[model samples]
Target: MRLTALALLLALPALRADEGMWTFDNIPVQKIKAKYGVALEPSWLKNLQLATVRFPNGTGAFVSRDGLVVTNHHVGRDAIAQMSTAAADLVRDGFTAATRAQEIKVPGLELMMLVSMEDVTAKVNGAVKPGATDQEALTARRNALADLRKADEAKTGLTCEPVTLYQGGEYWLYRYRKFTDVRLAAAPELQVAAFGGDPDNYTYPRHNLDFALFRVYEDGKPYRPDAILPFSAKGASMGELTFISGHPGTTYRQQTHAQMAYARETGIPFQLRAIERQKQALLALSATSPEARRLAAEAIYSLENGHKRLSGQLLGLSKPENLAKVAEAEAALKAAVAKDPALQARVGGSWDRVAQAVARQKALLAEATYLDTGRATLVGRVAALRHAIALVRLADETAKPSAERLSEFSEGNLKATRAQLLSPRPVHKAIDQALLAAGLEEARQALGDGHPFVKAVLGGRTPEAVAKAAVEGTKLDDAAVRRQLAEGGKAVLDASADPMIRLAKAIDPFSRAIRKQMEAEVTGVFNEQGGRIAEARFKVFGKALYPDATFTLRLGYGPVATYANGTGTLAQPFTTYMGMFDRHLGWGGNAAAAEGGVWTLPQRWLDRQVKLDLATPFNFIYACDTVGGNSGSPVVNVKGEFVGINFDSVYEGQGGYYVYDADTKRAVATDVRAILEALRKIMDAGHLADEALGK
Candidate 1:
């Protein structure tokens, strides 16, 4: 893993300086050394890798040698919801374990540490010829991948996943060690954690603490891993070089103009409208009562966040000036490919092929997205119909040999599918009802009310009535019922009298037909051609290109700096504790009044002990090339010292997915000094503070 500059420059010639999410094995050390006079050594990398961890949906890092994990509070909201009860509402009061024994383990939350990674591009691509038909290539690739995963797992005994990097140009087999037993240690009151609320989410000079702590356990004890991040209380200053270590969920810098257009025109708009509708619904539902509000808080906040993100993205994309830049980049790339005969033959037609696929998708988007089977999960968003569809598909796929089955339903995924289908979780009936009714109505609009499957799902009942009946009548809330149907296979599903099951059976054929058509025309074609296009891109850009993020651990760097703010004001690089208290004052005179006001600050935040150091930094801004998944990442200095916790990005940062603007778009982080101060003074967790500060 000794990265070299020649290796980087020669490897990816098209890579834009300061733009790539370089893998550890191929980091541009010479490049970094030249720019910032700092190059990460092998030991530095090992410590960084060991310190960082991946959650099911987010990222965090070890703050203590004893396995204490620190991440954004929003990342743990679902666990908070699960751990809450009638008398002991962790979400409302927040949880702080005075001692190690008091920490409660939350089920279903898992953390993973990257164990190893190996180049597997040749092995995977070896299965299909360059000229193979789309269908042939797709089938061969699936078989090779399934075999590779099974063999690797049996060999290494780690969770092995094949990462598709540079679209299809390269591949890596990433292995991870799983930690299923993670316990919630401490969390601040929601009001204090989300001080600025939705309005402050992506803005600079943020006062939000927005952090939570947890512990990873094994054999009923805190399992200290080899790779713990050394805590550094020393704060970052303006213009300091910093690096963030975490799995950024995704970025689309490699996407073609047509693909970006598809998202801008079809995907973003549809998703924004849906999010707004759901936000309105959730707000109305929560307004019903205090209890309702408590129940819906996490969900509502999520919708609000999504709404803002999409709205920002749409606004950025709609700008004609931005589109012109995008078009210019696309034209240059296309021209480069056409100029080279070899590149033309390879990636010459890729852009056009992708455009064709996108065009086809535009025609099928509505029917595909709103395709409903009238079933909802315990969580409002998950469609039981999809599980129902999966079950039916599983039966069909299972009937074939392992090689012939769809990759998703192959032997590798079957166990996970079964576990998910049979896992028990609490159901919020009202939420489920609203979701199903909304789904049914959407289905009517998309597929038309006269569609046979739509009529069957509605069953002559109105959308509201049908949805209500489905929620009230179905026994899917019980894991046993779902298990019986899933385990019993197709015959059981066909014979079941349960209204949801019957509806699932009725819609299976239509769903299956759609799946078949999509695979043949869209997915299969895209997979084959996409890889060739990737190869072409590699030829054009060489080592300079960074692959689209696949939720894998990555290293990206930037500097702590200030950016221009509209209205004749320049936003400061960091917000101080005094600013937080000042903002708190704007809420109300006292903690109680503030807690009841906008961006509620908890009573403890007004502690007199912490008052003197109100000048301490609370949160700060930095321009880092990061996207959504970077939340909760460990922001470290050149020496990899903890500086802040990467949480939200500015409104312009939403465009990071499509374009990386290092100037205006920046990342927001909770200052480590502020976290220590809060723990020491307001929360009175002096021991935890010492542990984090390495005192």
Candidate 2:
């Protein structure tokens, strides 16, 4: 959901009661026609119902025309790397197709289209009732959706997926046809593709030029499928109806206030804390281990970016003005519910229950933070125990025949384990020590060493002694450890001689008991007030709502321009080569200089007087709604012609996922002209330029 802080700043002017229904789906087609003076096309509606291409990890776009397809540079980077060699690093040097034959093929990459959608809401909800617990409802809904998907897949040639659109009940089966032959047509240098680096990410006045071109091939030729649509640069008519067809991941708009409150209080904070820890962990490890550094780079970037965005949302929610708006909206909803006897009877207590839940969990909110740190200490011991058990199983199973040996040993398990141990911040020592200490303390406090599991694991040794040996004496590199399990086989499994194994057996039941206790306490409070809040929210916001975005395709539109939010005026559209030079100069404590950094352009750029390009005002900003998943989305003119590629939104704009404003809702997009110019001249990727521009 968009953060309430930004929502308050861009609050729509109060509208008459009648205007509410106009934006809602209830309004007739004629009413929209009369107001917007444009006929809503049946084709547009059909297109809206279609799904855009999406990769396994959320990267894809529709087939635009014939073989032409669009997606983000970052998304296609892996494929580009796979197709490249040290002598031809597409990521650093970029690629361009001078002609159709020169296009680079990406093996195993694919495109998918949503061919059909069936509303399965009734089937899902029928499995569980209104009074059912969340877990029960979730399980029931999942099972029903699975059954529905299986049935649909049997009938249709395409793959069918049953998706929950609005939490548990609102479900739809989206059918898709997959194509696996996609190729790269063009790309830009990292300098241009990720222009602003980390600082400009998720912020406005974005200088990023994040776009990549690819094409779909079938039978060794350009695929001209029926799904491809011709590019239309004119865009939709101003003030006219338009529809965006894409795979929108998730939205939180439909969430009850109680759920949102949970997010605001418990969920977001926990996420922030976890992210912080991860970032720190990555940095510490990266400082020493080159392999670890490379492996953690992507993870660190994702975590840091998410942390920044969520932090913005939390700050937005904390604003007094925003809270007031929420309260006012809730009050109005309650009034509406009180007026409707039926609704009141159905949802009267929901809000109170939700509130009680929130109140009860207030103290326990920090539990997640504690667990985040604690888990790092516990997981290693668990892993060691599991590894030992696996070895014993492998030995027992190998007695049948040489060919019957378990696959685990031949696999990369040992190699991966060694690499993990070599990481600068290996978790083994800490985890073993923490688990050993905690287990011993618990045994002493509860049943003493007499408890069978405790006696088997720790009866002969003190906690301190075990901890010291585990932390300082244990050698992860010891071959004997692997051999001992390999030889012992069934004997090890039958005996409880291993302390780690004994502790591991007890941990699950202990953890479950703790979780149950916590849930019971929380649910009891929720049963009191949660229901009342949910009902109140529904009355105020109505049934049609958006869910939280899960980094999926969503269409957001606004104008082009910069914004001022006390951080300093963000120059809209873009920063020029001159500005890049200036930034470098400032960084080097020489801002007054005219020429001394990476921005020193090629002779051609200089010959053009730099002013020719910088002064042309080639860029425009808009409060277009976007999020992380929105990256690489085409920023089109009203006629739906691609003008630029959407990359990042500003920090202030992070909250825009929920609430959009005509102001402050800007996305960073690379201008099509600049991209073309870079390809044609700077990068000498004339072939790619020709295909992209249809030259």
Candidate 3:
């Protein structure tokens, strides 16, 4: 759809020049042509979209026709960790397969590439009858979506996912070609990949290498892709036009003021506290021994990254100016709706409905957050209790009809769900005990010790005692046991004697109750009423407004440019390899110890420093609108050549969740030139370099 002048004029007060994670089907080609004098042809967009692949947690793209994929090390962290053992420690030493047979098949890893998408908004909305109750409407919509997905999958034999756009204002059926047998082709050491660690995570002028390579396989051979992004040796220049293609996780830019308030006042605080408790436990565990640190490394890194991101988001939301801007934009939109009789009549009470949903959310927050049924799928971090919960829920959910089953258990998602449950990923009992004990205590405090859930879970024992027994006594840790229980169905689940399973069974009722309450009261209202509000927005501003991100494929364009650091200094867009060494040696008065730790240079890099081009761009910043899930995105120029891989965002970019400020916000990426240089000189992977550069 073309963005009209009326749309631009109406949205200019809120939307900026470089704002928007645009959908592939609705890209503003004319706008790009007019602004950058670069014509974005249909073939260019199509190839880019097809090459990009989605991981369980992040994004990547095909870098070679022979199925070599490039993404961030962090995005591939879980796979690397799974491939590591006490004997090998792949995460510490990194891995490179010199031959096709040598490539280690990563267990339970999957990559999905988008094949096509079709708008199904009318078909979904048509499910709801004229005056149905919210719950009925929600149920009908789910049934309709289920039918559509099942039919499409049967007909096409592809993974058909229903992607909710604009909060339910529209729905798109995204069909993907799934690749299950993914292998690790190359990965850098943890120290180099995550250099400067948590301190430099969300800050710019970053020097982390942060890139990894993978290859998808079919029948034990490399899977060739139809489209691949050619690696560019020249890379991106300062102020040059660039585009990022990836899946950005989530954003609340379209949220109402009440919803934002709920997030600020209630939701984020609860999550922050929960993460703090878990992080402290992991840190204490890490301090014990080298082995302990190895076991807890991925979890600690993830928690620390999340803590910083959420803290920045909270700070941004707390700022008076930011809040006032959100309020003003919402007010303007509402006022515009009020002035238009047709829009007012259509969406008169949408704001109030969303506010009411927020109130319901606040009332149920404690129960809903703590008793969450699906938390175990987080890279298998949680202990037996969460796994037990998954088993119990699966037994129940799988028994229901396809249309009536929970979304996670739907036909389209069952394969991934089953894969996650049966994954043979290593689990550390001690660390699990600590985290589980912490979670139990947190629940006790939040829901009160007298609460039914707390009572059922604790069962008159201390949180520590319960967690110890659950982790030590449960056989759910064994993949075979989980498989048996999963395949045996409810009778087997009901007969299981495992402490964790018993506990899961004990608390299953309360969990289901809260989940039902959440679905009927909070989520249903948000979707139904939120759709109306979206309609009101479209009526006022037209279709030019981008939808909130839903972790689906999107294309964002920007320029390689510097920005003010908010401290009377202009932060440069590029950082050189010399800067990385200086930071390691504490030459900038940075706190990284000169002798060792995360900032310490890898031995190979230190040995090859004289052979390297110190002036080569190591990392650079761009003004692209990005969020968490865009981490491994391939940043390409107009010619569709890969110049860099997007990794982190500066602290200021955290506010991009609600607003895009091109002045201060910057997306950080590793320069393709740096990757090439390191591969050729320092890493002793010239063959890999040759392949990447298409030699």
| Strongest candidate by lDDT | 3
What lDDT, from 0 to 1, does candidate 1 have?
0.75
RMSD of candidate 3 to true structure, Å: 5.1
lDDT of 2 by residue, 56-115 (tens): 434445434456776667767666665766467776567777777888877556566667
Worst 10 residues of 3 by lDDT: 8-17
TM-score of each: 0.91, 0.67, 0.94
Better of 2 and 3 by TM-score: 3
Show model 1 residue runs off by greater than 4 Å: 1-17, 129-131, 372-380, 383-387, 422-427, 479-486, 490-495, 587-596, 607-612
* Tens-place lDDT digits, model 3, residues 127-179: 88999977778877877877788788899999888888887788889999999
Where does candidate 2 have its weakest 10-residue lDDT segment? 15-24
Candidate 1 on 531-604: residue-level lDDT in tens?
Answer: 87777667777776667788999888877766665635556778988887777677665544543465556555
Higher-lDDT candidate of 1 and 2: 1
Whole-model Cα lDDT of every candidate shown, in order? 0.75, 0.51, 0.84
Which candidate leads the pack in TM-score? Answer: 3
